[model samples]
Target: MTALVQTVSKSTLLSVVSAIVLGFGIITVAGHVQAATLHDAAHDVRHATGFPCH
Candidate 1:
């Protein structure tokens, strides 16, 4: 029981750490992007994901 708990705790902690790292990376990269470039990227992503941009 204790071993199972420890394993779950470790997995949860790893997931949280990974999410934080990815979020920080996105924020850092986004901060350096120009407004028009970011808008274009978002528009492309929306189209690729089948979201109606118009």
Candidate 2:
């Protein structure tokens, strides 16, 4: 009985950690893509118009 309880606790801790790591990875990747999109748009606008940013 004691062994079973220990195993369950360990499994629960592992599950929680996995969930947190996955969440962080997802958030970071999404933020990166959003930043890249904005950067591309700015670059394109500068080329499209001869007016320089003062």
Candidate 3:
């Protein structure tokens, strides 16, 4: 009975950790996408307005 309880507890803990890790990964990817989009927009704006950043 104790072994069974331990197994269940371990499984639950692993599941929770996996979910948290997946959430963090998603957030990181979203942030990267947002940063890339902002960079592209800034590049386009500089070209359009003739503001050199070089």
Candidate 4:
């Protein structure tokens, strides 16, 4: 019997690391931001995009 092993390419590893860093940064910043501020930002974006948040 033979066992198969797989390895990650450099590009794939870099992409995964980048995504993890970006996600962590967004979460950390969001945690420190006030809920009302986030709501206002989202509300304004909704209006700008004509998504009808109201």
Candidate 5:
């Protein structure tokens, strides 16, 4: 039971760390991308989700 608990804890920790790292990486990359690109991506997403951006 103790080993199972340890394994689960380790897996959860790894998942959390991975998510944090991926989020940070995306933010860093997005910062470097062109504003037009980001705007177009956002526009596409809004339309795709039926948000009516325009």
Candidate 6:
């Protein structure tokens, strides 16, 4: 932990920590969602990104 703090700038560390917290929160919320709802959301994202989900 000390080595990482010494090697990384404050902004970089802050960005990494923020991303980790956001990802964890998304996972936690998604776990409690209905399976059909999750699948629909993922399907919409895939289409939005021009990916072929079907």
The whole-model lDDT of each prediction reads: 0.66, 0.59, 0.62, 0.61, 0.65, 0.70
lDDT of 3: 0.62
Q: After superposition, how far is residue 41 of candidate 5 from its true place, in Å?
A: 9.4
Query: TM-scores across all candidates?
Result: 0.44, 0.45, 0.45, 0.48, 0.44, 0.51
Residue 14, model 2: lDDT of 88
Off by over 4 Å in 5: 1-8, 32-54
User: Over 4 Å off in model 1, which ranges?
Assistant: 1-8, 32-54
Candidate 4: stretches off by over 4 Å: 1-6, 33-54
Per-residue C-alpha lDDT of model 2 across residues 1-54, encoded as one tens digit per residue: 678656677779788779999998864444333465644655545445542322
For residues 3-38, write the lDDT of model 4, one tens digit per residue.
221376678878988999999887544443446766
RMSD of each: 6.4, 12.2, 11.4, 7.4, 6.7, 5.9
Stretches > 4 Å off in candidate 2: 1-8, 32-54
What's the TM for model 6?
0.51
Candidate 5: residue 40 lDDT (0-100): 71
- Tell how far residue 23 is off in model 5, in angstroms: 0.2
3 versus 5: better lDDT goes to: 5
**Model 1 pairs whose backbones collide:** none
lDDT of 5 by residue, 1-54 (tens): 678657677779789889999998885444434467675767655556554344
Clashing pairs in 3: none
Q: What value does the lDDT take at residue 45 in candidate 6?
A: 63
In the range 1-54, model 1's lDDT, one tens digit per residue, is 678657677779789889999998885454434467675767666557664454
- Indicate which candidate wins on TM-score: 6
